[model samples]
Every structure is written in structure tokens, then in C-alpha cells.
Target: MTIRRILIANRGEIAVRIVRTCQRLGIVTVLAASEADLDSQAARLADQTICIGPPKSSASYLSVDAVVGAALAAKVDAIHPGYGFLSENQRLAQACSAVGIIFIGPTEAQLDAVGDKLKARSHALAAGLPVVPGGEVDSVEDARALAEKTGWPILIKAVSGGGGRGMKLVHEPDQLAATIELAMAEAHASFGDPRVYLERYVASGRHVEVQVLGDGENVIHLGTRDCSIQRRYQKLVEEAPAPNLRDGLRADMHCAAITFAKHLEYRGLGTVELLVDCERDTFYFLEMNARIQVEHPVTEAICGLDLVAEQIAVAEGKPLRLTQDDVHLTGHAIECRINAEDWTQDFRPSPGTVSRAVFPLGEGVRVDTHIQTGARVPPFYDSLLAKLIVHGTDRTQALERLRHALAQCVISGVSTNLPMHVELMQQEEFARGGVNTAYFPWFLENRATALRDQRVAKGN
Candidate 1:
């Protein structure tokens, strides 16, 4: 059966993304928004809109009752919890199923099993995938012992959280306890779950992830994306066909990801992120994001697939129309996240009315955005204003196109991370590829001139 209508249970660019696909497929869209997002493009463009609750996320976006109620009130057949917010919440998924509304993601059981990072590691290991060097530390003393055994410079991570929240990196044994406490506190405050895990932090590693689509019985990997360019653990730029991936490494990573997904009987869209140590020619399973990712457009750009449409199809119990062999990933694609933040001020949120906003339109450039000239950037949600995705036959061509697109793009009345993205693209090491995760932080310290050049370019 085809989906009649879908309720978008989140906000920002993803909401706009799903609405566009629904329109293309002739499926109606019901958008549920917080009070702050009542004026959002999703609310404006959707066939139906409902005010879930107040601007505060707890009373609105994160509130399972409000979201499910909105779905029931809209009389929609399914609910798409776009990335973030309640996307990975097992209770929310179960609630949707309880009301007979399709949850456009994996089953509650899968979510629960993978929600905890340590348990997910076991699952990956059981599926013959390589896991990281650390796991759940039973107590503070156990955490100390694990840190000593794993060596210093490890990461204290909140298993239940994403978006880089609830994480701390300790460079020495002396800092482990303090970092763990901070991580746990942040985790408890951010996700309402204080559970934390440990992992050996690779100083220089490539952040490679495989995108997979499943229909309970079968799983197919679209391709790999290199997301090494990040700040504060939040990815800023991503590209398909990860640059300089060794022969067979891509296939191995894809196979491992698919194995993990099929083992859990995963359904719908998900991404398994991994850390590839280029120097050692080895990779380790990091974590699995059990929902459509923000950078999914890059995957779609090269694979020539409509992931959102496939997601809806899978949610409706339709088989993935394409086979593993049919999923051919071609060309090179890059995506730059355009966020409403001031790069000069440590990427502080810059929320205000966009005085003048114009997107670059040209060959290979696809702008996924909900903001316009007069739209007000609300502080209640994520600062992501748009995603600028471009494709080309190769990495060089893709980079050239990205530079041109950024040149033509325009935004006003708010400082943005556009400057940082442009600079990172032009960085020599980034252009060469095969750099590790720590490259960004190192670049921030060593490349002051690049940042200056970016400011000058922005002015012109």
C-alpha cells in the first residue's frame, strides 16, 4: 500500500526535505511544529499544519504525546521523525506503532538494542565487524582501569546522545575522572540518560560512514561518505566516495555496515559511522545513526536515488525497488552545511531575520533550504539554515563547483558558518584528503591565515 499522508515530526531543513518528496510522490504532508516554528517553511508549505506545543522542545518537539497527537489529529497514516529530536527514541517509535501509524524508521527493538553504544558494539562484533577499543565501564574505578589499559587520550561519550553533546576527550590519565564526570553530567542534562562509554580517540582518522537502506529482510548500502571535516564533533562538510579510500576498503566497510543492519533486521534509512585510521589501513565501527542523516543529500546526489522516497516506500512495507547490484554510486558529491552562526565568535548562534537570502542556482548545485529573505531564524531549534549540495564527475570538479556555488550564494542580517566552510574547502590538507579527525582542530590552531583569507573573500 502507498502512503496516503505522512506527518513530519521534526523541524528545519529535514522537514522541508520530506515535504518536497511527498509532494513529488503525490502524498499529502502534515507538518507538526513547535510554537517557534509555526512560521517555518514546513508549516507554510505543508497541506496541513498543527501547533504541537510551546517553543521549548520538551513541551513540543521532544514530547512524544504532542507528536503522536499531531499525527492522530492530522489523520495521517505514518510519522517521519526526521533526524535529531526524537528520531532515535525507541519509545516514540513504539508509540507510533501502538497507534497503528507507521514509524518511518527501524523497529523499536532495533532502536533499543543500538541506542546504547556499548551494546551496539557487541552487535557489530557479533556480526563480524571490527569494533572500537573500548566499551561500557561498569563503575568509576572500572572506567579508570579501562582508561589506563586503553591508554590515555580516550573519549568519554554519552551512548544515548548525538550531535556531539555529552562528549569529552581526555588527553591524560589525570583528566579521565573529571572528563567522565563532565560527560556524564552533560549526557544526563541533554538526553536525560547519564550512561557513558569509553573509546580510544584516534588522533588522526577519517570519519567514513556507510549509508544503508533496508526492508526488514534485505539491506543494501548506497555508498560511503567521508565526514572528516567537523568541529565539536558536528560535521560541517561531507562528500561521497570518500577521497583516497584504499582499494577494497569501501567494499569492506559497506559489507560490515550491511551485516550489522541485517543482523538487527533494520528497516528504512540508517547510517553506520566508522573511524578509519588511514595510516594503519584499518577501520573501526564508531556508532550507527538510526535515522536519515543531515548529509544524506550527498549520498543521493551521487547514487541517483531518492532516499526520502525510498524511506516512505519502506515504511509502507514496499520492497526497496533497487537491488544491491542496482545501487550504483557514481560521480562525486559534496555538501556544505550552511548554519546561522558566527564563525568569528567561536560559531555562536546568530538568530535573526534574514534580510536578503539568495541561493546559487547552476549545474550540479542543489540547495535544500527552508529559509527565505523574510524568515525569522528561531533560537528554539538547530541553527542549520540550509544545505548546499553539489555534484561532479570527480573530487576536483566537485570542489570547483562548491567554490563557485558558495561565491554566488548570499545571506544577510546574521553571521554564518559559511565563511568557515569556504575556508575548509580551500585548505591544502583537506584538498589532499586522507587526513584524520583531529585535522580540523589542528587546522583551527595552525591556519590563521586561511581564516583571514575567508573573511576577505566573504567581503568580496
Candidate 2:
């Protein structure tokens, strides 16, 4: 089952990342690109490239038939779906199999196991892991009744969702009915599934996840990552070996993640996300991503492992290269998702041609990006332009290293969230590792209010 050649059914930094790994492994790569990405970094790096369709993602990246057709036409041994678009689409995996091509991520059954949040919660609970106070509801009344038991400040989420698309937070009983109705409508439009569920909302919780690898037999964890810094439910910053995690609690969380992955027979690279109530020193299963996550570089920095290469090896039917006993974690790594968005405009997408792109340079600094001078930032895709990662021997060192690197980064002609990252690094709470999922949005609002007060005081 050796993979001689593979087609990347994706585009972006992730696609380029896969190309580099394939090149290092001496495997030929065929990049499947939309018309807008024909001149992308991934296209240039691939040994061969094919135009799948127009720039519209629906006709190109999301088209299972188009991706499979390209793979079959090229006679590739496998197709790698990089992190987004069709990455977790079980239909894409099935299509690949139907065309006699290997899909390098999870199998259809495995995808089904954790694809839906509600079902994933059940799976985690069955694996001896705890879950939040939540359950699927049939109607608004059902959600209202569950919320009453879960207490006020309940979260209503779409059963089939990610990135907080169909999620609503209801703080009082009077808001339940309207919130549930709106959430259901949003869910139906977003995922074509109107089902909703209610869960207890944690007042202060840290978003933590474990990096895991499975070979259809056993699963091993790389370590934990703290992704507490977020905005609009999107991760803005991530750090490996979560800082300030309680000693025994950290061990328990790791054990739970490993158990959950093994119970599902997870294959390839996946992330088991959890929400930890830091005050209570307890955690609950959130969801599982059955593909390489965007924040994987932090795990790689600390463990000194190439996750993508391991994914390919596993797809070739090779056992995991390292066992759990071999895992030796050291140092602290932090990653900033440098997106092409204007912080002044609520992180609105800044899609345009880059006049200059200069990232940081030096030891312990890594820039995973595809944009360069004159590169067009397509409007049809995610705003993520690059990932700025830094590593050091400890959390303090890593924080300082990241701060220095963010200051040095200079990507002109496109408004980015770099200012926000720079500002966050200087905050006392963030420096003390006291950040949680709500910290970023709160910081932004407070910062704006302070600026307005300053202007008023100056009689502007």
C-alpha cells in the first residue's frame, strides 16, 4: 500500500504544507486547484497540477465528483484533503474509494462516529469521558425544558456544526423560546439540519485539545494545546502543553482523550477538543476533528514530529512510528493565526493583492504561509493568510519569543489581525496565562471602550 503519488484535494497553506511533506518523502504530488488557485504556492510546488473548476468553492473544492474525477484521471494512489473544504466530508472519502483511490484521512464510518456534535458527545461519554449538561431537543419547548435543568446562561448549538455557526447563548428564561427558534433556523440554513441541543454554558472555560494519532489499532497522544484565545468562535492563538493546567487534571484529560480516540478506532491525525472549567479543575468533551488541525505546528514544535508525513505513512498501512512510551515533550510553542482581516472592521476579510509580505525571521520562528508579494488573497476562501509560530524552552520564553516575532512581521497591502495579537501579548492576564475562550472578545470590547473614553477626555 505504498503511496507513490498523491493528489492534494485542497488549496491554501495546508495544501502547500502537504506538498512539502510529499516532496521530502520523494513522492510525487498532483495539486487539485480551483481556477483562482492555479498560480498558488501549492500549484507551483506540486509536481503536477489540475484545474478542478471555477473560483467558486462550491464548484471546485466542495465538489466531491470533481476532486475524485481529477484523482482518477491522474491515476494517483491517494488523495489528501487538507484540513478544510472536503477534508472531513465522508462523501469525499466514499467517492475516493469508489474510484479505487485512497482517502488519506478518516474512513466513512469513523467520520460518522464524531462528525455530529451531539453524536460525538454520546461517543465520548460512552468512552468513559464526561460531557457537558446537554441533549438533543425536538422542539423549542424541549430545548426550554432542558435549559431549565441546565440552569440559566445555557448554550443552544446546532447538532451538526463547527465554528459556532448555529450557536446561541441565552442568559435568561425569557430568551429561551426566541433563541431556540433562531438557532434552529440558523442550523437549517448552515447545515441543512434544523436539530438543536441545549448545554450548560461555562462562565469561564479554557478551550483545550489533544493531538492524537491512530493506526487503526492503538492511539497515542502528542500532548495538550490551550486554544483559549478566540474571537467569533475562531481560534486566534494556540499554545502547546497548556500553561497552568493542574497537574492531576492534565493527566486525567490526556487519558480521557486517548481513551475516546481508541474507542472510536480513530485513524490518521485527529484532535480531541475539550472544554475545561479551570476553577473546578474539571473538563468535558467538546468535539473531535478527524483531520489535521490548523494548529498542528505547535505539537510538532514541542514533539519534533512531522504529523503530515506520519499521516501518509499510516495511510500506506504502516504502524505508528512512535508509541506512547516514546513521547518526550519539551519546550513551549505558540501559534498566531495571521489572517487577512481588518481588526478595525470586526476582523472583516481583507481580500486583495499583497504588495509586500515580510514575516519574521530567526531561530524558533516559523511562518507557514502561501501569500507573497503580488499574490492575490482570494475572496472566496478563508481569511487565514499565514500562521506565525514560535518555540522556546518554557512558557515565558515562548511568550516573549512570540511577542518579538509578531512585532517583526510586516504584511503590507492587506489589513491583518497582527495588531490584535501584538496588543494581546502585552496584557497582564495573558502574560500570566489566565486567558480563556471569552478573553479575546472581552479584550477587544474593552480596548474599544478605553479608546473612546480617551477621545472624549481629549475633546476630540
Q: Could you tell me every candidate's TM-score relative to the true structure?
A: 0.96, 0.98
Tens digits of per-residue lDDT for model 2, 294-354: 9999999999999999999999988999999999999999999999999998788999999
The total of clashing pairs for model 1 equals 2
lDDT per residue (tens digit) for residues 399-421 in model 1: 99999999888999988888778
List the RMSD of every prediction in angstroms.
2.9, 1.0
Identify the leading candidate in terms of lDDT.
Answer: 2
Per-model lDDT: 0.89, 0.91
Regions of model 2 farther than 4 Å from truth: none
Give me the runs in candidate 1 sitting further than 4 Å from their true place. 449-460
